[model samples]
Target: MDKLGNDELATILKWVQDPHDRKSLSLVCKRWCKIEGFNKVSLRIFEPNSLHKFLPRFPNLLKFESSETISDTQMIFLAKTCPKIQRLNLKFDTFDASNDFGDHGLFALSKGCSNLRSVILRKRRGIRDGGVASLAKFLKNLVNLDLGFCKMITDEALETIGKMGSLRSLNLQGCCLISDLGLSFLANGILGKSLVYLVLAECDRISDVGVMELMNLRCLEELNVAECGPKVTDIGGKAIAAMESLKRLNLSWLINVSDDTVFALAEISKNLVSLDLTGCEMITGDGIRAFASHKCLCEIVLTSVNKFNANDLEELVFGCKSLEFVRVDARLRSWIPVTEQGNIFRPNCWISWRL
Candidate 1:
């Protein structure tokens, strides 16, 4: 362990002694202060100076999750100090202003933390599209990034994000500013790269054209366009079918999908394990039958509004032997047969399948 690289040594700090002791150690000596252990420095509280003092010491830090209160000033301080930071998880109450996160703090972090892999800015308000552009400008190594419930971000942010080549998994659910225009960034441009998971649930503005553009990423594995408004149609479904790596799709509450989408899915991705078409009123028994052909499906949700008939239900009941959870009209039901015939959940039940 003593012969490890500076990167490796910093990682070892997480396993050292108590949390309080770790904090004290950073202040003990200049050698210890510069010891690549920023990520290991657990935080019960984060103030501007303390974070500023703690961050520069570690160069190998990967993830930082702040459970306590953190101000924008402190966030910028921390980001400025940590250049190699990979995953930044800021779930603080004070991270945003009254209406948005306007790239001040985020810009500082992205500028310094060029190696960022995943970032989750959950529930922080007042962030706009410009901040997204800032993120794309700096954090080039992002794999998974989520800006959930941020009202100010627009399609411009999406465009910037799509242009970043390293992006694999992205979640922009409830971001009301996005529209189909962002697809121009995700079009045939980055098709050769590997983008596995993408979620645009409840964007309201994004439609089939965006989904169609996304299909070009041949390595894409899962997609969740659930709760999107009437903008999404079967055209998106056809595009999804062409993605060979797609194993799961969530179109819940879309309310527009019909049999055509299901048929395309059935013909292409035979490896599907989870399919949610809940609240899709246009779906019928034929669609369900088409979905049933996905023998690997284990979790299915068909909720709200009338679409399918009795025959479809019966076939679905008989076919999906691997089903573990099924939702119907907001009600949760466990459908996996509990027989001794090999405990139903197929292979890996606990692992996050895809979407």
Candidate 2:
């Protein structure tokens, strides 16, 4: 081991996949520890308060994750120490009472870490429009951004994001402050050309007008507008059907959408693979059966949609050859015969009876 060079040691370290084994290697000697720190690319800081003490050891880190309530000072230190970081995850499951981290830290990080490609700030209350704007302005290579549950951001933040041509995925789930105008900004700019995945679930402020604007995103493949209030009716649903590139869609709890939207989706969306229509009380047996002729639909969720009977399910199971999974109300299990249920499962499709 004494004869081996730093390059050879790093090559051997590459094969050490186990964290415990890597920790043991780092303890062998000061030289080994220094080499290990230099080679470390990803790190998850359990105690962000002590970041300044240990972070300096890993200057070439590409990814950093912390679930703790990291303060502004710690974040600034990290940004300066690890300028090459490409992915950062600062998701907090619970809100912090201290509110020590905010836009100042975010601005500093964005200025220092210009190479950031993916950032997840889910459930962060401190991040407002100013921070987001700074991120959009500095991180030009950023592709995926998750601002879910960041309730303070409004249309102003989206206006900055709409200009980010390289951004491909955005999550605004639970951002109630954003309205139809924000959606229009995202739909009209260069960002529309690249964005393929978007989540707008629980954003109740958005209605048919906002949803209609999404049709301009020609490359969008997956969308989630579940639980977006009763304002989204057949008009919004029909607009979604226009996106031929859509592969997965969640229209759950959209109670106002009727058979027309279903028929449109069945006939228009050729690549649709997964669809969730749970709690869609307005859709009936005819609406459910419309998907029988669809070629690419494989997974569907109809739990709580009581209008469809067992006969409609039977036709759907028999007609759609690509179907592999179906979720329905538990009450429907007794309506279908045991032999038919067995037959349904035998043909590579499984049913999930939800209570």
Candidate 3:
């Protein structure tokens, strides 16, 4: 190994995708350890106190994830050490009191990491609109941002997010405070043209009025409004279908969705590849059967569906050659034919039936 140059050794190490294997290789010799540490571009750590030690080791880190609550000091350390960071995922352990990294840490990070392209901040109660505003002030190159389960955020923060013109993906799952007006800000904001993927799952306050605004986002490819309020019905569904670029749609737990909405989706979204209709009590076999002709559809989840019988499923599989996986209610397992059950183990397609 000593005969190989550092660049060549690093190139060889690139093939070692498994972290454990890489760790073992690093222990082989002092030179290998130094090369491995120097070449490492991604790192994830669960311990908060060890941030200083690890931050200096990976000078070229482009992606970093701190599983624990990273404090303000540690965030500053990370930003200073890894100035070239492109993606950062900061998660807070709610049970741990000491993991208090609030807006101050976020401000420090935003000030130092101007080139950050993507960021995920999950379950951080300390973050509010102020932190989001801080992020918008800098991080102009950011492409994706996830604030899932950040309960403290309000609609005011979205106004700042709308200013992020480069953002392509945004997730506000479980952000209960966001209303229809906040969504309007995103739709009319500068980022609307660039935004392609959006997740509004469990944002119960959002209704058809808010969703209708999103119809203007022609570039939208994926959307998830699962578990939303009853106000999201056929009107919003039709609007969603009009998004020609949409490929993946999740309408799970939408109690008001019916056959008309499903048919609209099947007719309009020809390029759609994946769909989740789980817990849609109002959708029947007639609605789902419309998907039989969808050429690009690969995966579907129909858990707790009441309308689709064994025959409907059989016909669906026979028509959609691209169908790869189907997740259905366990009770329907016995409804499928024994011959088709044998096909479950086939390379091309399979079924997952569970409680």
Candidate 4:
């Protein structure tokens, strides 16, 4: 082992896929430990304050994650230590109100690590528009960004995100400040051409006017506008139905949407595979029956939707040959007989009875 060169050691280490075996090999000698650190590509730190003590050992790291409360100084140290990082996950619990990590740290990371492709800053209250602007300015190849529950982010942050041509998936769930104007920015520019997945759940400020603007996103595949307030009626729902590339859609709790929207989705959204209409009280049994002949729909969720009956569900299960999963209220168990339920189970579909 002492006769083998550094290159030979690295080659042998690459074949040792088991992490335990790799750790054992590193303990053999000081030189083996150094070689293992050089080849390391990913690291997750539980205590970020002690980052400077041992971070330099892994200079070739490509991915980094931390859920602990991190400070700006520590983040800067991490950026300077691992410049090759491509994915950064800093998601922490929403209850942490510390202002230690903010735009200064984000700017340093974005400037130092230009190769970042995926960055998840969910529930980071310190991160405002300035940090997001820095990302748009520096990280040209960034693909997936999750800014969920970042209450400080407004239309100004979205304006910068609109110019990110390489970004594909974006989550703005719980961002209450963004309105119709921000949605318009996302619909018009390079973002429309690149983005395929978008989540706007719990963003109460966005209404039908904002949703109508998203019709320009021709490449969009999955969209979630669940619990986005009552302003999103059949008008917005109809606009969503017009998008041909959509496969998965979540419109849960949009109480204003009636049978018109359901019928439209059943007729137009030819590739839709999953549909969630949970808590949509306006839609009746007729609306639930609209997707009976849908060729591509395989999963449907109707929990808390009291307007539909067991007969409507039976029709949907029997008529839709591609149906595989159906979720409905537990109250329907008494409506159908045991023999009839057995007949309904003949097809390769599972029914989830939820209370």
Which segments of model 2 are wrong by more than 4 Å?
343-346
User: Candidate 4 lDDT, tens digit per residue, 72-108?
Assistant: 9988998999999999999876547485599999999
Question: Per-residue error at 164 for model 4, in Å?
Answer: 0.6
Q: For each candidate, give its TM-score against the true structure.
A: 0.75, 0.97, 0.86, 0.97
User: What is candidate 1's lDDT per residue for 249-345, written digit by digit as tens?
Assistant: 9988776677788888777877777788877888887877775556677777776646664446656655666655655542222332335223323
Which pairs of residues clash in candidate 2, taking residues 3 or more apart in a chain or in different chains?
none
**Alpha-carbon error at 118 in model 4, in Å?**
0.4
Model 4 residue 177 CA deviation in Å:
0.9
282-352 per-residue lDDT for model 2 (tens digits): 99999989999899999999998988888889889888999999999989988888887765553688888
- Cα distance off (Å), candidate 2, residue 30: 0.7
TM-score of 4: 0.97
Best of the candidates, lDDT? 4
Task: State the lDDT of candidate 3 residue by residue for 1-355, as single tens digits.
Answer: 7688999999999999999999999999988888889989888888878877766878888998876777888888888888888999876556353557788888988888888999999887778899999899999999989998888899999989988999999999999999989998888888888999999999999898998988877788999999987989888888888888999999999988898888988898888999999999999989878888888999999998888887677667777889999889988878777786664453677878877
For model 4, where is the 10-residue window of minimal lDDT?
91-100
